[model samples]
Target: GAGVSQSPRYKVAKRGQDVALRCDPISGHVSLFWYQQALGQGPEFLTYFQNEAQLDKSGLPSDRFFAERPEGSVSTLKIQRTQQEDSAVYLCASSKTTGPGYTFGSGTRLTVV
Candidate 1:
């Protein structure tokens, strides 16, 4: 892909339902990141993966949030049990290296009812 691609541009999840968001980063990019953006707030870092290795995940809010880049290109962020507080836009960004030149995806907007 020419840029990062995200699936399910909009999602409406009933409370407690599981949701899986996909992100396809640009080919050859080694750093992939996931961020959560609530209404009116900046994107909050959730996790980062470098070539299938999860380098940092301390920013993930809870255990219910899981992200994996199995082959270092395509990634998935899964929320086990959706909640009202979970309603937000999930953003994915990729870069050739750490700390800059990041290209972000449009993101998946999730609404938990």
Candidate 2:
């Protein structure tokens, strides 16, 4: 089975630009989650989707952040009008169920200038 993976392990963006990062979850997984982790801080939940249905998105910081899991597997997180504060490691994880553990991608490190 394929493990979760994320692209552009590092990114540098100028403030006010838009960026899109991609994530590929494991096959047949029913739950997917996105999180943001600031330097030296724990990962914070950003959103979650069960298949193509978005189950939760309470943790998205602002309107600038948006995510989607269209095909019930692959997902993308897009940031509009990037700001310095948006700099962080964006992580994606998936699980067979809402169980205890999840498989996480390496994450995309975004740096807003």
Candidate 3:
């Protein structure tokens, strides 16, 4: 892809339901990441993967959240038993290095009701 792509730019899930968001990062990028952004708040890192290796997942709010990048290109984030507090924008970003800038997708706005 020419740029990162995230599906279902908007999602509405009833409480206790599960939701899976998808991301397609820039072609050939080595590093991919997921972040959660609550209303009026900055994005917080959720997980990071480097070429199919999940290097970090310390920021995931709970075990209910999971992310994977099997082929090191496209990724998915699954959240189980969604709650109202789970409403937020799920952002995906990819970078060649851990360094400065990162290209981010528009994000999937998940709204739990």
lDDT of 1 by residue, 7-33 (tens): 999999999999999999999999999
Candidate 2 pairs with clashing backbones: none
Q: What is the TM-score of each candidate against the true structure?
A: 0.98, 0.96, 0.97
Residue 72 local lDDT, model 2: 97
Best prediction by TM-score: 1
Model 2, residue 109: displacement in angstroms? 0.3
Q: What lDDT score goes with residue 112 in model 2?
A: 97
Question: Which 10-residue window in model 3 sums to the lowest lDDT?
Answer: 93-102
Would you give me the overall lDDT of model 1? 0.95
Off by over 4 Å in 2: none
Colliding residue pairs in candidate 3: none
State the displacement of the C-alpha of residue 110, model 1, in Å, after optimal TM-score superposition. 0.3
Best by lDDT: 1
Per-residue accuracy of model 3 over 14-96 as CA lDDT, tens digit each:
99999999999998888899999999999999999998999999999999999999888899999999999999999999997
lDDT of 2 by residue, 10-110 (tens): 99999999999999999989999999999999999999999999989999999889999999989999999999999999999999898649999999999
Cα-based lDDT at residue 52, candidate 3: 96
Model 3 regions more than 4 Å off: none
